[model samples]
Each structure stands twice: as C-alpha cells, then as structure tokens.
Target: MSAVPDLNTAPTLDDFESLFVNNRDLDNVRAHLSKFNPIKTMRMARMEIRHSAILAWLLNPQETHGLGDKFLKAFISEALRGHPTAMHPSALQVSQADMMDTEVRREWRHIDILLLSPANKWIFVIENKFDSGQHTNQLARYLKLVQSSFSKDDFSHIRGIFLSLWDEDPDDDRYAPINYGSICEILEQQAVSGRHPLTAEVETFVKHYLEIIREATGMSEEQKELEKLARQLYRDHRRVLDFVIEHGKATDFSFACDSVFGEGLEHGNIVEVDNERFVFNNCDASSISFLPQSWHKALGGGKLYWNGCENWAMGFPITMWISLTVDADGTSGKIRLMSEVGPASDHEFRHDLINGIQNATKTNSRLRIKFQAGAADEGRKYSKIFKKNFFNVEDVQDQERIAELIKKALKDFRPEIDAIADILPKFASYGKFGKSGE
Candidate 1:
C-alpha cells in the first residue's frame, strides 16, 4: 500500500531494504546517519550529566517506551527489599502525567522524582546524581521533608533511593543506592524480550538509547568497531576533518569554559604566580587566577563537595581564591569568595589565620558570611554569595554580571586579605610564637 520512491530522488525499494532497513551490519551510510540522531548522540548521552531527564523518563510508566513498569519495579526492588509484591506490573497503575506532579515540588526543592500512592500507603523518593556531588546535605533535607509530610505509618512505608552513575553509598544511611548500569540492563532485557510489544519507532528509539548507555558503560562492541572505522577514515582524510573540527562548536563544556576563561583573561595584566601549577595573577596582578589545568588540579583533585570554584587570591595567610561554581547541568555558574587553611601551612599560621578570620567574619555582619573550620584534606571553608545562573553564553550582559560579582566578592574580601598579608610578615618575624595582633 506504500508508494515506492522514485529511483533518482531516493533509494530504490530493493536497495532500501537490502542496505538500510533490513541490514543489521554497520554500513558506512548507517554509521554516518547514526551521528545525526539527536536522541542517541545528544539527549540520551547527556542524561549521564542531566539527572532530571533520566528521572523523568524512568518515573513515567505510561511513556509507551515498551519498558512500562519494568524500570520502576527493578529500581524499587533494588532500592528496597521487603517491598510489597503489589509493585509488580499487573498491580502497577502509574499515570505518567500525575506522577511528575505528585513527586516534584519546585518552590521548596528540586527533587528528581517522587512517587506516592495513598491507597497503597507507599512513598518513593529518587534523587538522581549523574556527575555532580551533593552540596549541603541535600538528601538528608529531602528525607526530613518526606518524614514531616507523612504519618508515622506512612513514613514506615517510604523508600529513599540515591541513583548515581555507579554504585555509590549515600551520605545518609536511610537511602538505598542504585546506578545507571541497572537501567541499561533493564533496557537490554526489554529489547530482547517479546513480552512488551512496542511500535517500530519506539523500538528504534530504545535501541538508540541503549547503544548510548552501552557506550557510556564501556560495554559496546558496536561502538568499538565504529570508533576503529572512524579512526581509519580520519587517518585517510585528516586534514579535511581537522579543519572542520577546529571550526566546530565544542562538544565538551570544560573545553568551552577553558577557551572562554583563557582568552578573556589573557589580555589582562597577568603574571605567572605558580609556574609549576600554571596559576596567574589577575586584576592588575593583585588576585591569583588559575589556568584551566590549574583550576582542575585544585578543585578536581578529589571529590567535589562544594560547587566548582576555579580562581582565588594568593600570598595570604590562608589560601584565598575567586572561584566560579557551575551547577551540574552546566546551565549557569556562581562566583565563590572562598578561602581555606590547609595542613600544609605552618600549624601556628593555620591556627592564627583561622582564629582571626573567625573573629572578623563574626563582627562583619555586612557581608552575611559564616566561617567553617573544616578538616585539613576534606571540605574547603568558603563564604559563597551572589548565586546567579547564566543561560545565554553569547549575552555580553550575562558575562558582565559574572565579572561584576567577582569584582564585588574581591572588594568585600580585600580588607581581610590585606590583614592576612600584614600578619604573615609579623608571624614570619616572630616565628611560631606570633600572637594574633603581633
């Protein structure tokens, strides 16, 4: 009943069936076309970074992706043992439309997914963490809300899940943990089984998404073969591909951030303060700014507990730096007026600096700052403010706003930095016996 394509304009019926539709092998044309699938290449792959997207897909049972109730049941089963067998497929009556509304409360907190059933007296909270670390006991706070909202009987029925890229234990013992690998397995099983009859379109989409997950998990033989072919193709046409790639937009957020920060700050009166670390003196060489690698080394050295902060001032009793804190989604960033006293510093200096800053921050209520004396190698003590999210990268106004926030934070902290710089000399002169005012 379908009209045949004209040979000149489109592939003939025989060619289409043989080379494109029915072909299971990775042909050059298929490989090239696969790159253009936004779901496979961008949206699905990006779910590894964007937790909300993954939560939405998984929480929705009626999405007709043919994995109905399967992902949710598996996730719930993994997160909670002794869960009601009523969570099975036949007993599941999840309305994808209502599930999001019941789960997500935007004004209070941006929870990834929430599911509630009054009849069953059940509550499930899923907090999805792809790449970003928790900042301020986010899981604990969310659990508190859940407890307060429900009765003691209902509270007993609650299950908290921390969904991550890998099997990570939650900071809170209350939360059970699961990972993307489980979700990948669910999709793979659904694809293989004929139990769920899906439309051809849905099947193709699921396969594409599954491929992305497999690639991310390093389990994709298809990906390996395609990559090998790509390398050979690039070797044969290196110059042409290189030119095209050089002019293309960056696929990685860190690369874009590096390019923007490096180019924008290079014109300033900068000096290499730490040549080994590639830290630079910025703002007429008063404050210390980090080159991209230095920034990564400083912040990405360990598990990122706070937001990402990249630059700071140098030559103080405590390490004071200006840092840009980007959110998990890479949508926006805030400037952090951050400082820390590390164990590497002299014990006398550390004690003196911590004591002085603690006193100063208390009296200076104008800035509304707090002091946290953290463990040496653990979290960094910071006074972060002016939290803003910039979406439009091309907007000069957004860029200027970030610059202004950085300038304000520096201006506010200048007096403390000067005091620290002043004390460093006195402390050096008096040796380890230096008093606070000395």
Candidate 2:
C-alpha cells in the first residue's frame, strides 16, 4: 500500500480556501459565491435588490457575464406578441436590428429601464416590479412621456412592458404584462440551444441569475438543500458570520423604521413586539395584559396584545370590555376601536350592540360601528367601532409625521371611544333584555 497521508495536522486557512475554490466546477463556484458578491452584499442607492441589477445586466452587453442582445430581443418579442413564444421570424424584426443605447432613471420622467434604438426613433420602456405594487397611474405617466418624446410615425412600436415576478394587469391597457417565468424560459432556451454559445464563466453567471429569477417567480424547487448547507456553514463559522451579519447594512424598510419609531420606543410611547414590530400605545388604558401564546397561534399575525378597562367585565355572565388596538405590519398602520365579548352563547349580544350603535349613530354620526357576531365555539364576539389605516409602512417619513398622525387619530376618536366604553358593557348586558333576575 502507498504511504498513508497524515490525518493529524489541522488544515490551514489557505488550504481550506483552496479546498472550496480549486478544481470546482464553475457553476458550483458561482452558485455558492453569488450571494457574497458586493453587488448583493453591499448597500448602494442604485441597487434596489434585484430591480437595479436586472436593468444593469440588460444594459451592459460588454461587461463580464453579460447576456447578449438575444435576451432583450426575446423580452421585446414577448411584449409585442402578448405571449411567451414568438409568432414567427418576422416578430423579432419589429424593433431596429441593432441596440443603440440604454439609460436608467433617465431625466425628470425617471423611467426604471429605457432601451433606445439608433436614429432617435424606436424606444422600449420597461417598468419592473418584484414585490411592490405600482404607484398611482405610474404606467400612464410613462406612456405619456414616451408618446410625447417621439411621434407615432417615427418609431416602430414604442412598447411599454410591466415586468414582474407574477402577472399583474397594468392600470393602463397601453402597457403589456410579462412575468419572469417567460424570461427564465427564454434564457434557458439560449443556454441549451448553443446558437449563441456563452463561455463557461458567463454561462455559470447566467445560470446563477436564472436561478434567482426562477425562485422569485416560484418556478424553481424549494431551496431546502441550499438552506441546509447554509445552516451548516453558519454553524461551523457562527462567530465570524454573526459578526458580519451584526455589522451588515439593514434593508430600506428596516432603516426607515429605525429612523421613524426608534425614539418612540425608547420613550415608551411605542411598545416593542420584536425587532421588526411595534405598537403605538397612545390609547389611555385602565388595564393591560399579555396575549396568550395559544391566542397568538390561533389568530396568526394581526392581533398581538390586549388592553381595556379593569372593571368593565364585572357583574356580567360573559366577559365584556371596550378597547382600541394600535396594530402595525409591513403594509399598513391602524388604530382599531373594539368591544369584545367572550363565550358568546347566542347572537343576541351582537343584535343588542347593533341596536345600540344605530341609536348612537343618531347622536354621533361620526361613529362607524360594525357588529361581528361570533359563534360560541369561535371563542369571542367582537364589535368594531373605528378603524382607520392612516399611514403606509413603505413611506419613510420623519417619525414626527407618523407620531403626529397617530396622536391625532387617537385624540379625534377619543370621545367616541370613551362613549362606547361607558355604554357597551351596560348596553350589552341589559340593553335588549331585562335585568337578569327579572
């Protein structure tokens, strides 16, 4: 037998690096290293996650790992035909044969991605969305800009594309909808066909990008293996990885939230749920209690904690209380006025609340109350009095703006809340029916 290699010496850092990088297939290296690249790991204004990356890749044909014009051509073809596959050879020739220029966030209009053909004629406007909904009439504004720039006769088809992870109908019918699934399919075709053969290095990069797009579109397999591998790697290098993550840049939403709510939390006006969650407790409370873990499990995300008057439930067979919830999530922030009656045996309590609301409506027209009659088995009956979604979570305004709005909403509705709290327990117990003894 040949001499046995020494197994006792621990591997050096360089040796480990070589073990991971050397003699490995290019695709494997790319798949493993893509997430660590500066474009992904570093924070930059121009990079909006995958949004800017997609545009940059499309714009630069001579850059490393560049996808040739065929991908752009295929995308345009799909936009024109309103389907995945091209109609015929002639469909590809709808635009000029050559790509002249590409611009991102072009002057005042600030279009996301703009592709232009030579002779200042044909233009293709692409608006890409990953998880965000379109702003009010953004597509129409873009269309108007493009129409005003070039006359109808000067260009072939001044096509507007709404490229997204999922198919969404554009607000304006003038824009065409195309999803990443079609783009992935076209890239896969190019990879396999070898008509425009890509070098191995570029092929690996394209495959890495395709996988990301596929995962976003929900076309790829669940990333269990990758997740498992990542977990193991993190486990092995917990100290180093933890330090990196701790110092790493926070996302746009996270940074904005820190700027908006951080001080309020420090001052105790906002209560913390976790790093990502907080509730504005501007509601003056007589009682506060932690929500049971089981309740959280059953209710999922919307409800978090509970607060109400201390003696509101006294002298009633069923527990009844009036309260307001300061609830928030990524999409919206709201203050909800509510009255809950637990163990609702029949629908009579709801009818009583409804009658009381109608009576209250005559005196207080601003009060909008909804009675939700819950089955006994459903655990609780609730009457919603006031619900206003005031601010969007995406808009990163100053903390003062959000705090002021929250304070105003709570203050404006205070009289109504106080009125209902005083009347609800009394009205729910004996409003419709006579006293319990009688």
- The number of the candidate with the highest TM-score is 1
Candidate 1 residue lDDT tens string, 1-438: 865433334333454344335444436637655576546444445443344564456556666565655556655665555423333222123322123223432224566777765555667777877766765798898878887988967535666778777778788766777777877776666655566777887777667666666777667786787788777755544444454555553423323334333544542233332232233444321123433222323332222222122222332223445545555555445556555543323444445545554555455544333444243223333332222211222212144555555555555555554444433433343122212322
Deviation in angstroms for 221 in model 2? 1.5
Give the residue spans of candidate 1 off by over 4 A. 1-33, 40-44, 47-51, 62-68, 81-108, 153-155, 227-438
Cα error, candidate 1, residue 334 (Å) = 8.0
In angstroms, the error of model 2 at 350 is 45
> Which ten residues in a row are the worst by lDDT in model 1?
301-310
Using Cα atoms with residue i matched to residue i, what is each candidate's TM-score against the true structure? Answer: 0.45, 0.41
Model 2 residue runs over 4 Å out of place are 1-50, 59-67, 83-90, 100-108, 151-156, 191-195, 199-201, 222-438
Clashes of each: 3, 0
Steric clash pairs (candidate 1): 311-322, 312-321, 312-322
Query: What global local distance difference test value does model 2 have?
Result: 0.49
Candidate 2 residue-wise lDDT, 49-83, digit = tens: 34545545655444454455556667676766743
